[model samples]
Target: MNPLAHLRPALDAGLVELGLAAPALSARLLDYLALLDRWNRAYNLTAIRDPREMVVKHLLDSLAMAPFVGDETLADLGTGPGLPGIPLALARPGLRVTLVESNGKKARFLREAVRRLGLANARVAGCRAEALDEPGAYDCLTARALGTLAELVRVGGHLLKPGGRLLAMKGLAPADEIAALPPDWHASAVHALRVPGLDAERHLVVVTRRAA
Candidate 1:
């Protein structure tokens, strides 16, 4: 039995549920999953071994935030295996994505994935998130399973332009982390995401900087 045969239907269903009903985009997403699956065997890029689970957890979970992404430059901090960044880039061809990763192997995998997927709007940055010093370089930033809201803003805040947004994906509605946000920043909205076929509680924390 072919894995994509099983995975395709689920992926298609999930994408439609997420309001991404484009057949062409769905096909490209599956291509990314196939590439990730093939590399995982050798590089262990992701801990999720099952392809079906990847469809739900990685693909759908990431795409769940597509509705909230703005059409501008986005920097994905600690983008291991290019989560929301890669998928978002595929969905929005006009959006430029910069995937920042420190690990050599994962960074290599990201570069290869971008090349093989022919994502001309995407690029890989082989460095740590905190080391990025491009103040106001991006209009939006994303971090998936990366860190607390405070920590993410503390390190990646400089990368965002004034009035820019940070979309942080987390398992739960981290109240404590939200409470701990820097005084200069505030939670604009916290959206609870519903990833198709995923029973886990997923939330997208939308944070923005306060004017000086």
Candidate 2:
């Protein structure tokens, strides 16, 4: 019996609420959850140990950004255990996702997850976001629970194409962070994400470079 089977009903309901309802997608997400649960036990990949909580925080929260993601190359900086990166790749097969992590252990897990999940659309970059040499390569970038907007752009801004955007996931609307953005960067939009079962505030900050 699948250990995560009991959590499927809630997950499916959450997917339906998010307008991403699909049988196969739900199954795959659950499989990924199971894998994450297994690895978390030994690797301590994440603090949310409860499977039900993982369904809410990890799967649903990550999928919340799906509608905003375009079918373009994306680099997920500071991707610890492939939060939105893996989930986004699984949800959008056409999307090419790079899971960028500096930690050796996390990178190893990312590689194994990619191989085990058969994620042909995803790859792992085991290096700091600043050290990644691929400038102007990605059409979009995502950093979840990474850092302040200024710090994130400082390290990963060079990776974006001229018109590329950074989708920074935060717990609440960050007005101060937006104000602190370096002169060259700006917040184009702020999207409120409603992750089912999670009552806490969630926001996606769409940041872009200023016109020269």
Candidate 3:
């Protein structure tokens, strides 16, 4: 019952086409999914338990923005089950990812997963964004299924460097939220992305800091 047999082609094609990691990264992703599904039972990490859906909804959906991640450090805001953050980090090993969650149970799960998965670059922070001391220090920040664009920007603004960007993973286009962006920090570019193995509804909202 090797999941990779069914997943390899679609996963490879998706990552390669999306410009995520090389096709080889898919194997690691598959391995990671196995662990996720096992932990999910006790941890209640994610709702979707099916491997296929996990690949499409979680893994591929996260990699849609691999190109934009570039060399900057990334933080996952309000990360509950590590959808876009953990998957994104698994896909792009070179990227630095901080998974922020206020829940003690989820944070403990993430820490255990990071250690067991040998994810040296992935870290778990059990705190609200405002409580952290570092401000305007991150190269990139991300919020997946966290909150409205305005709210995320307001709370997570201090996490981004002066010229860094914020990547928001959303289920639909955020027109009203985009409109409400602060003029100085509004999006400089908005890219409508496609995740190869995921649902068409997936979108990556990129907002870079605009100069005043």
Candidate 4:
């Protein structure tokens, strides 16, 4: 059975239709997943052992956010296995993505993926997002299935620039999370996502800091 035969069509079609797929993007997605699977055995990089799940959850879910962020520098906080970070970077090569991971093992995997994939524009910061000296220095701060609304906003808020957004890939409507933000923060639309070939509850929460 050809692995790419069945899966490529839907993904390629979706990306092209949405204007997200670029040259070599699909190939890199395969490489990225292969590396993750290879390393997971030795390092436990991700919970989803099945490569197919990696495609649906990690790859597709991450790519789903591509259209939203659109051409900006992104910082992915607590990028455990590069869920949305790596895939997002692959989907849009023009975007400068920094994957922030505190655990040395996970960080190493991210760096390995970067080098192997030849992602010159991507960098992996093996440090806590809070410790990174540059505050609010990115056009967007992103996280996928990372934390509670408060915990997510609390840690990731500082990474976004003054007007930059925090894009959280969550399971359902982020109403509770949105309400938790101070009144000053703006809660943009919570767009529902329809990721091809995957049955998962997906939502993209766009947020900004509360004005003082």
Top model by lDDT, which number? 2
Error of 4 at 48 (Å): 0.5
State the lDDT of candidate 4 residue by residue for 1-212, as single tens digits: 23444566656666675567764787777777778888997899888887766677778778888887667899998889887888888777688999999999999899888998898878999898778776867999888867866776677777778888888888888787777876667677688988866777788888877666
Per-candidate Cα lDDT values, in order, are: 0.91, 0.94, 0.78, 0.79
Better of 1 and 4 by lDDT: 1
lDDT of 1 by residue, 109-163 (tens): 9999999889999999999988986789999999997888999998899999878
Q: What are the runs in model 2 whose C-alpha is more than 4 Å off?
A: none
RMSD of 4: 2.4
Candidate 4 residue pairs in backbone clash: 184-210, 185-210
Question: Model 3 residue 123 lDDT?
Answer: 90
TM-score of each: 0.96, 0.98, 0.89, 0.90
Question: Which candidate achieves the best TM-score against the true structure?
Answer: 2
Clashing pairs in 1: none
Task: Order candidates by TM-score, high to low.
Answer: 2, 1, 4, 3
Judging by TM-score, tell me the better candidate of 2 and 3: 2
lDDT of 4: 0.79
